[model samples]
Target: MSQKSAPRPPKTSPDATRRSEKSRRAIYAAALELVGEVGYAKTTIEGIAARAGVGKQTIYRWWSAKADVLLEAFLDLGEQAAEQAAGPGAEYGIPDTGDLAADLKAVLRATVDELLDPRFEVPSRALAAEGVVNEELGREFVAKLLDPSLQLYVRRLRSAQDAGQVRPEVDPRIALELFVSPLAQRWLQHTGPISYAYTDTLVDYALYGLAPR
Candidate 1:
């Protein structure tokens, strides 16, 4: 049996894994850069492959369309941002320090920083603009990227409601919009300056209301 044992299958080396990871990152970077530079309408699999320095077949092997590549690229960008914001191996979610107001402010402030980051700002704006005009892409963008983040706020707000910090009658999802929407509008529309101070005030207003106590 020892002499007759079938040849063992070759195992993938660490170098192979590293090379694959490197190629994947290059692809993501190429996709974001191209979209930011030329808008989504003009970005193509062939173009992305060229920019990424990979063969067209490599892209086709991983993704069926350019849309899938761009969406995954955005998701990767978000994940990297989250890791940078929270630290390595950190789980993505709103923090619950039992102080709902403080937690909201902290998360929003991080969002403010992210929005202002050049690496994130340009590509995100480009994609968001495209989503506005493209119906199917818009739905997918909301479902995959936007809604997951929104759900985190919903869960945090629901916890606040349970603890009597937020009113029981309030809807957590809609209540999140009170503060979230204003910041989003300001950033997306360039209607106003975005800052930590601005987001903090928004949280105060949403939690305590504008009228005097």
Candidate 2:
């Protein structure tokens, strides 16, 4: 068997790290803002570079295409959202406080907050609307931006399964969507109002289901 590789060294200097962080933040903000203002069709690497006040070569040095830039920018948006919305030491992972209902409620509530934030909402809707008509971009977006969060639900549901809260035969992936998809649909389609009450009901409905449990 191949031996385990050695761990990589940590970032050494605070200044270098800060510079990297600043550049990354600027790029993400520029991408999101540009997409929001101009829509995805008009969004370009050059536009992001201009909005970010960075050289075009700098963006090219980091990402190959506009899609990559937007996707990574969305990912960075998620990071910033979590940081601002969640408490210190909290992360994107599912809460495992042992009360599955509470954890789900907390997460959904936070998601409701994020979906309402203009910083996240505008760009996301622009991209999502484009995805509705663009198959390749849709799949790519789902794979990178969406699947990671879905996996966290999988983990939480798996734990609930182990604890005899969720049924063993239930597919965690689909079960998670029973709640997730509804909210996403509501937000993306303007099908209904997204609120804490809405999400709280979603958690209850997903767990007990709509079959009068």
Candidate 3:
């Protein structure tokens, strides 16, 4: 008997690859827009497929649930924002310019701008509201989406410590909250105006401490 050969891997054409990417982005855009407009509970995979102008099978092939789709979509959106702010090839991380305060201010000012973006704000609010009531999603999204960004702060703070800008004994994770929490509360509560100036002041207070030197 002749020996059997292993099956060859399927090859995809460049045009086909481009088409796949286009469809994926369309799905992400549709998912975000729908969730923002209707809230997560009301948003459906079918709706996303329809808005994306792709078959339901296309979405099903890529994502098992609306949550998964939204998760990836938000991640992609963040990447796009980073690219716009930091230029092409920008991966998400805090920029260290040796001057920790100036670097923090730059990042936070970008954050202030992001909060004001309608494309980001609406869908984010929907997801955040859901996370508030749904404990599982709350933990999941926080861990997956929010924690990465928080860790970047940790990394930056640790670097600051190495440079003697921050106290060596300080916990980078906890120390970051001094600046981050105030901005988070303002955006979530809509209790105060958010601006670069406000974030700059927060950074000043956080880095130098509220007491006099």
Query: Residue-wise lDDT of candidate 2 within 1-213, one digit each (tens)?
Result: 978698665766999778767887899899999899989999999999988988999899779999999998898778867877676556668789989999999999989988998988999999998999999999999999999999999999999999999989999999998889999999999998999998899899888877864
lDDT of 3: 0.93
The best candidate in terms of TM-score:
3
Q: How accurate locally is residue 171 in candidate 2, as Cα lDDT from 0 to 100? A: 96
Model 1 lDDT per residue over 73-123, tens place: 999999999999889889999999999989999999999999999999998
lDDT of each: 0.93, 0.90, 0.93
Segments of candidate 2 deviating more than 4 angstroms: 1-20
Off by over 4 Å in 1: 1-11
Residue 66 of model 2: what lDDT? 95
TM-score of each: 0.93, 0.88, 0.93
Give the clashing pairs for model 1.
none
lDDT of 3 at 127: 95
Name the weakest run of 10 consecutive residues (lDDT summed) in model 1. Answer: 1-10
- Lowest lDDT block of 10, candidate 3: 2-11
lDDT per residue (tens digit) for residues 1-213 in model 3: 977697664588999989999999999999999999999999999999999999999999889999999999999999999999889997778889999999999999999999999999999999999999999988989988999999999999999999999999999999999989999989998989999999999999998888989
Q: After superposition, how far is residue 142 of candidate 1 from its true place, in Å?
A: 0.9
